[model samples]
Target: MGEKSEIRMTNDKKRIVIIGGGFAGVQCAGTLSRGLARDQAEVVLFNDENHLVFSPLLAEVVGSSLSPLDVVVPLRQLLPDVLCRTETVRTIDLAASEIEYESDDGEIQRLGYHHLVIACGSVTNLNVVPGMADHAFPLKTVGDAVALRSHIMAQMERAEVCPHPERRRWLLTFIVVGGGFSGAEAAGEINDLVRSSARYFKNFHREDVRVTLIHSREQILPEISPDLRDFAGKKMEKAGVSLVLNARVASATPEGVGLQGGQFIHGGTIVCTVGSAPSPVVGRLAAPTEKGRLLTEPDMRLRDSKNVWAIGDCALIVNAHDGQPSPTTGQFAERQGTQCAQNIIRVLQGQATRPFSFSKLGELCSIGGHSAVADLFGFHLSGFFAWFVWRGVYLFKLPSWAHRFQVGFDWAWLLLFPRDLAHVRARPTDRVSHAHYQPGDFIIRQNDPPLNFYVIEQGEVEVVRSSPRDQNGEVIAVLGPGSFFGEKALLSNEPRVASVRARTPVEVLVMGKNVFTQISSTLTPLRDALAQALNRRRVDVWKDEPQAYELLKRTPLKELMEPVPQPLLKPTAALAEVGHAFVEHGNEFFYVSSDGQTLDGVVTITDLLRARAAGAAAQTPTNQFMTANPVALAADDDCAVASNVIRECRLKALPVVERKDTRKLVGCIRVRRLLAYVFKHAVIGAPDSCQARNQLAGGAGRGMDWNNPAS
Candidate 1:
């Protein structure tokens, strides 16, 4: 409505606007165009894509039996009399009888309609499982099918060149979650394609390729009879497909799927066809919804709205024939579309609308290798003959003869030749992404090439390094949310120094090497923070030494800290008073407080010099030059923690308090004194001094200057 163009009605004729181009929307538009005169109404259809994807054949696309375009029909060609629009519908205003859509150039446009049909089907949603959205392949769209096909070919290519047998086995494995029609068909096709194609590759063996289908139910194909379901399952297993029944998926990760009872299935490729949610536009409507689907009356009209109609997968419509909610399938949607059109015509003709009724035809599912199962009318069929019937029915179901002919030719060609193995080699682009890991999963291995920098978002990970004393790696640090890792190896352009494994189920924001380097180098604050963390982690080597670890743990801050050198001053004390006190006590800094007991602020010699350089008078309040709420340590903290804090904050010394809550001034720990203590007791003077002293003194000398005051 804001600066948007309004589509004016031609000759003041009625306009019918449909919001999707799926089976329902297309059939409704076609019926309306044929039933109404040109002068009576104008039919306008809106869809995000120009073509309608035949979802039933998507698995064949992934198996490379059909070209990606073979299963799609152009909407404009299918509905010549209807005005087809590819603009994305943004909002529906039922009160105004208008809908807003974004044009190709990103300009908003509005069109008023006498009638509105809601038919936008549901969308694929993988968020039901923890990591499924990030790691699994969805089979809901044409693009999804093509992307999965390319990934399958890429994995096979990688396996051919892999030197290790275990790694190659992982690469050749594929897992499909959900035992529905899509999942079962995909698993069957994947097994057939990989096994049949293995004969051509010199390094591949049929036995090494594994295709697993995981279903949570006792048997698959619940839409058909139990006999057909059993036949389909047995046929798939006989064709070399592993079926895991009665198992529920707890989460999905880069490694594989994790089951509810702590079973982890490891595979290289994972396909998910389980979850779905209503379209965003439909979900936003102000109407009663059941399980995210818009509720509609028996006549296919939206509840309490005469001019608005709802149909397809986005709507929950009760079928008069079955006395139950209609299933979300192509057959049901097409029938609903036809009946809804008749109801709309009846309303215009001043006649009462009829309730929608339809008897379901049948259910058919292909199990690859020229075998399928079918339940049609009262008859059930399976095996090669059933596969032929399934193909015959869907071939004629194509929108036009041209499409049917093309698909039929492709099917004939597939019978004579092997499936296509050629794929476009697209270079992967570096970007930031998210990843999930289950407990005990290795996120990164020691000595592996660093490819991603990780920032923890949830759960915890352990940084593990190999040790001479134990075969299992030692956990040097446990990192939780807000912590980051992998930057050390990336910044140094070397292999990982330590392996990172998930201590609990974890999620992390991962940035590729190039993206991480570019952002960190350009952002000064981020760069400085990473450098500080690197310096703090560099001292972890001392923790692995038994004597050094014991010494650090035994010594407390109260024992290592020196007494406060100068008397504390009030907050309102003059700068001249602070300078005189510093010179008298021969200290570089002094604390300032209102009562001299509670720690408030600190003023250093650097603060006084800067104030003087700025032409500040000696009468200026010291509070103006003091740092408020400075970093302080508790008296009970150990020397190891103190050393790490000093190195991280890059401070000469830090104030120590008796207790954090009391804020009573106790003493201060100096960097020089801590370093001397560590060298004398833990490294150079210790009984196990040779290795510890050489490693620390030699490797740490390049960055540390012992005599420098600020070190």
Candidate 2:
């Protein structure tokens, strides 16, 4: 009998989990798989969809120049050696180092991991204009492109046969909201399709069909120079697509769009191609955001949570050169993904991880046919030169040689064949109601066979463990929105640890076992993150201090109230001066603190109104009615505390003061100012706040807030 030599196991083998199959995720997985040796690591791609969508060519797909399948490569063939699974990851357990997902078969599963990579891309940002979700078409997913194509073809056909001229106009009119690269490209492509297709339809008048591009800004493709944007605008206008500038779509209906200028353009189909942000998952993480984008550190790591890393559209990684996060373009996203992969490897290998750096190599947009606009390495070109460069760059970036070959072949074949119009219907999984769930519903019964891990969508649920002496358990923990349950069972393939019942009508997603396992196996830190989240819920003592106002050092000034537009006085002694200031100047108040450093209380014209109402003299010190306390806060105090103090005292115009020696006021934040700040600046500025700085300073804390809309 001979003993077999012991097999050697090294740290070379690593498991990486990727959540999306978009350009970023696909590129990361493809690069990692091919770059590493067989024994080095394992790359597992977990996606809700089975194919990788070539996002840059999506407009072509919609234009009938290319088919949807032509742009989508099957994940299995794209990365042959890497593991590919179609599952919806529902929860990330960071503390326990695992992830949970719902498989197509409706079973919950979990996967443990050694490393994690989040390449989840952005989704279309709807819910902006009224009736947009119900009526507008978005061009993000493959299905969306196909549906828009079908709708366009069908509308052309319908317009030709219609007897009424108004109906025909409505049917032929196409309005695209936004003038960004996507919008301009989509408008141009659709215009080209209509120009070509109308030749075949007899009853439709090509002139009757109107194509309009509406933008809220003065220029399109802000990524390019103003001169280039003007050039693009001129090209679009020459092609018969009207450019509506400095106007936004206020609302959308099946019939048309209502512009901010009150101009109504009737249309059969409306397309929105505005840029997007991180997935809704970012919101749940409770971190700062920049315009709905998750803020990341210079190293492309999330602000607070370490051990966690986010890339692509999900992260607002600052550009070292411009002090701005890289744009959400396919090129930047792919670069970020690759950089993220490199960082991941370095982190796992105990090597120094490098921060993300951005270089503006190029920007391109296809106008129509072979005509395009491009800016490469500070070199700008148009027409054939730009188009050819666009093709070459994208071809080189394709995930695999097989995919590149397929795409190239398709491009060549398309010249000889008309585009195929076959529709592929991928049924949606209905494991959970996105909108509603009632109380007493057993989300997952204890002792029952565990199927799917539940991702809370809305409302609340209760995780109850039977008391040691009782046969049935009473309510124990109330899980609110964004909290997940059934994670243990999903990750370990083990029996249910507790009974989860809905405390209110709750909405949740059920993730199957295989998918959960796949996600867990790839994103190791997620397992620990999720467990820490649960533990945080369990140990939270905030509930005990419901009425307690915790003093925060960085109070958000935007959360405080601002004064309405009242007239400003010239600091005169006359009552007429103050009254005239309120009505004539319309400044709303005196700018007592124009300088950034030495600001005091502002005397608004509205104070006159209150004084008159109380039958008090306007000259009565002008300080008595100043509301002495005025809810003061330090300039560096937590912004959160400002809002709490305002709410608690029911006051407006909180003073942001310096507490060191002078205790002098710096600025007065009015309720209105606060509200506007929250509505506007919070979407952009908070991503660069102290909270983000503190979190990114150090620690394996979770990355960006997975649930914040700003993220």
Candidate 3:
């Protein structure tokens, strides 16, 4: 108790870490901050990039309708209170309750957490096709947009200087792969840009620029109905985009793309819109997964680690309504973020958490200016109507009201000015040296002082416990590739409880836990929980297996120790507004208690003001000024129940009481504590606090705000 007291004194506020700065991750951070209104919790957002890109509007950037700045929000500005880190997540060590990633300076870090929100988002899948990496540009990010724009413009310049007609034609050719939204939109917009810009080109005619869209599948816009696909294809054909169906490029080179049907298309520019895979971090967890996405229950929680959560493109969320996984889209991602936030709150409040349901409101695709196709609840529409709807929906969906106005202005001004062509490029970093370790490799010895955690790219390991009871060790569990060990000891300064021996030749990601804490503090909650859980125990043992999970199962939830209890009314109860209570010691205001509980006071900013307005001196009794009833809660409750009490009562804070004595009010548990609970765990449950300290020290908590109550 004394140790915990000292720990609490040093660290008063709860910390929450969000891993991605994308739509889902950002929304989670923002919502937690706003919904909770206290300084007891902090929220942090983490990402590899310092800016938040509206990926859905990447086509606009390529089309010159929006500049990178207009579509991107600097992390520091939007989330001033929330910490932000730009780093690439390499792996998730579920067993040790931490995440490992590389920082901007190339230093590896490990983040410990109590909860985890796997919202790393998706990346363009470029490894599937041979030569794609060397020959094609993917329109998934700002860099891709800039590269395509520069290449297209450069081609135009070269066409004017080239004397040979064939060379100029090849220079003007543009090939797009996948024919999906990204491919189709880029093809259409580039075609429009070239056709519109050709009037100013000295030698190139509009006919010189040829745009071709290649699809391996039979249809385009697979999200839409078959009829709509045909309509979209016809529309593209009319707009001068050559549609190639039922075939894929066998290989791509700087010279051109070779199709499977023995046909080769020569083009100076190739924009590939191949499909995306779940973030590589998802692939690093040894949990049940579908394809590259982490497998989550209907409630968007990991199957084995119930307290851990996976959302957005990184997770395979099973829809309870239909028993199918939700589609990976911006809309669904937004919804999942919101739902996950709510569930996190619910779990903290000791309430029943709900499963995630895919609510299909509508789907829209923009072919070009005022040219679009949309399905709003199965009502298909095309052309201008769809365009308006698309514009309005996206405009409203922008993160902030400021963004909506900016987008509106951009739309209006695009008609007057040509698309900006200033190029923004991200230089590639030096390649990392490949390190190898075979199965049965002794990466590290058990009980050695803290060091780095490893990310497994391949193979497996055995987690063995060698206690004094037996000279020979017993294998506790088998950890396959993607599973991480040795983090707990590094994270909490505790001795390793078990030995990890590679079962097969394996690839491992290694990083210092402190560096991770510094870089990813805000982006991960599981680390926070792990740290908290570790602190709860006096004698800690770091094991290679799922010790954290097992410990969580064993620990009984208890009411937090606090001040004397006083019962008050639930916030939801109807009451008349009254004047403030008399000010007392230390700027405190007194208010009436519920059911004639004299000691129970609802002292707040409002109560103090009412007394001053009435010119009541300090000598006046606080009883008359106090509200007749104030909200109250039981101490022996889960976070979910506490949250519901606040929501139901419609109050800012509630005085908590022991389950045996509801009339007695203990130390107050405000909405902020609940928010902190959510923020720290990234989910809802008890956490290992020691791991969190290492995560924090290691820079794993780069983006978390420990003081932000909303988090």
Backbone clashes in each candidate structure, one number apiece?
Answer: 0, 74, 93
The whole-model C-alpha lDDT of candidate 2 against the native structure comes to: 0.65
Over 4 Å off, model 2: 1-13, 35-40, 275-277, 286-288, 409-711
Q: Candidate 1, residues 1-711: lDDT per residue as tens digits? A: 244647777645789999999999988999999999989999999999998889999999999989989999999999999999987788888888889887777777888889999999999999999989988999999989999999999899988988768878988999999899899889988998899899988777999999999999999877789999999999999998999999988888877899999888888899998999989898778899999899998998999997999999999999999899999899999999999999998998889998889999899999988999999997999999999999999999999999899999999998999889997866556899888887777888777788889998876576666645544764444555677889888988888877888866788999999999999999998898798676656544443454554565568889889986568888888988888888788878888778877777788898899999999899999888887656567687676556544543456788887853445788898876766676676343344544443333323422221111110
After superposition on all C-alphas, the RMSD of every candidate to the true structure, in Å, is: 9.4, 22.7, 29.8
Q: Candidates' TM-scores?
A: 0.76, 0.57, 0.57
Question: Over the stretch 1-711, how does candidate 2's per-residue lDDT look in tens digits?
Answer: 222212232455776778778877877787778777767787888888889888888898888877677688889887798899887776666665466776556666677666666667777776777656656899898888888988888788778788768768888999998888878889988998887677677887668779999988888778787776777888788888998889988776556788886878778889998646567556555667887777777777767666566778777788777877687778888888788778777776688878888777878888775677888888888776777787778778776787678778876776676555443444334243232344554666566566676777755565555545644663334454555777656555667756777654456766666666667568978677666653433332222222211212223443352432333222333555556555666654553332333333356556667777888764654444432222255554444444433432334545555541232555556544444444443332334443332222211332212111010
lDDT leaderboard ranking: 1, 2, 3
Position 517, candidate 2: lDDT: 64
lDDT of 3 at 564: 35
| Model 3 alpha-carbon miss at residue 568, Å | 97
Q: Candidate 1, TM-score vs. the true structure?
A: 0.76
Best lDDT among the predictions, by candidate number: 1
